[model samples]
Target chain A: DAMVIQNPRYQVTQFGKPVTLSCSQTLNHNVMYWYQQKSSQAPKLLFHYYDKDFNNEADTPDNFQSRRPNTSFCFLDIRSPGLGDAAMYLCATSSQTFGDTQYFGPGTRLTVL
Target chain B: GESVGLHLPTLSVQEGDNSIINCAYSNSASDYFIWYKQESGKGPQFIIDIRSNMDKRQGQRVTVLLNKTVKHLSLQIAATQPGDSAVYFCAETDSNYQLIWGAGTKLIIKP
Candidate 1:
């Protein structure tokens, strides 16, 4: 069973188009996070949801938004995909504790044309 | 902002040999540190973690050493295997849930 799953392992979209990436976790973790990683660089936090509370990173662009309908599902919405936004988007989950180790899903590779 | 960092960007070792990866963090208040391994096309997988109160922690084939004095952390893998070849990253978290990540080190296992 996949602990965390991301649909469409690879996604391609045109510039300025709207695209959505979905993530679901079977672990029922209270904390879910979205990260954007390009090439070999460190993954940057876009936003997260702790239960139903949404937290956005200060540096995250306004074009990126997130929604968590329930405990098990989360979605990343790119209102206007840009060439710079083409990268691997990773989804992770963790418990409520600050030190709890996060479990990750296979990332979705996004390509902008 | 202070962030987690690593000295080396890549490491190479032979199979059956030991591998060591080093990381440094400037945030003295960070109470938790974690190590993750990411293979090509996959997200990071948790390998091990250490709490600020502890200086060292070990897993089945891995050991984590934390030197609060120097604000350094390290991961040691015993008898490295081919499957161990991946990008390794260190993350530090304060009392908050937000985590600061270090640029990963690519581990190359020579078989």
Candidate 2:
């Protein structure tokens, strides 16, 4: 079974346009994370939600926003995407237990033109 | 400020041979470590993990070694296969539960 799911495996958006990527999980985890990964680079932490308490990374741009309406759903919203925003967006979920392992979705690849 | 990094960016290994990937982390406060495998166009999948109290853990065909003294971590694959060819990353987290990731090591399978 797919524990974590992201819609629209691939997305293309015009520059300065708004885009939203959705993530859903069946694991019923308490934590959800969003990461941005460029080619040949590590995944950068964008933000995460610990049961509706949104936590944004220090380097995360203001253009990026997230909403977790419930434990099973989380959304990543880019107010205005730029060409630099083109990358693989990954969604992960984890429980709060000690030594908790994070489960990741297939990921959504975003392309900006 | 603290981060995790791989010793090598890429490694090529022969099929059926043992493969080892190494990582270094700067934070001594990190108590938990995990190894993730990311195939092309796919999200990272959890391979194995170890806590600070233990130095070693093993899974199917995979083993993770942690050296807290040098703050080094390594992943060993018993029999490298084509399916094992992917980017491997090591991540660490402290009490805060924020995971810091390494750049990753691309394991190439040589025929």
The regions of model 2 sitting more than 4 angstroms off are A97-99, B1-8
Docking quality of model 2: it rates as acceptable
- lDDT per residue for candidate 1 within B12-81, as digits (tens), equals 9999999999999989999999999999889999999999999999998999999999999999999999
Docking class of 1: acceptable
Regions of model 1 farther than 4 Å from truth: B1-8
Give per-residue CA lDDT, model 2, range B1-111, as digits (tens): 112333548899999999999999999999999999999999999999999999999999999999999999999999899999999999998777778888899999999
Interface DockQ of candidate 2: 0.38
Give the lDDT of residue A77 in candidate 2. 96
Proportion of true contacts reproduced by candidate 1: 0.47
Error of 1 at B100 (Å): 0.6
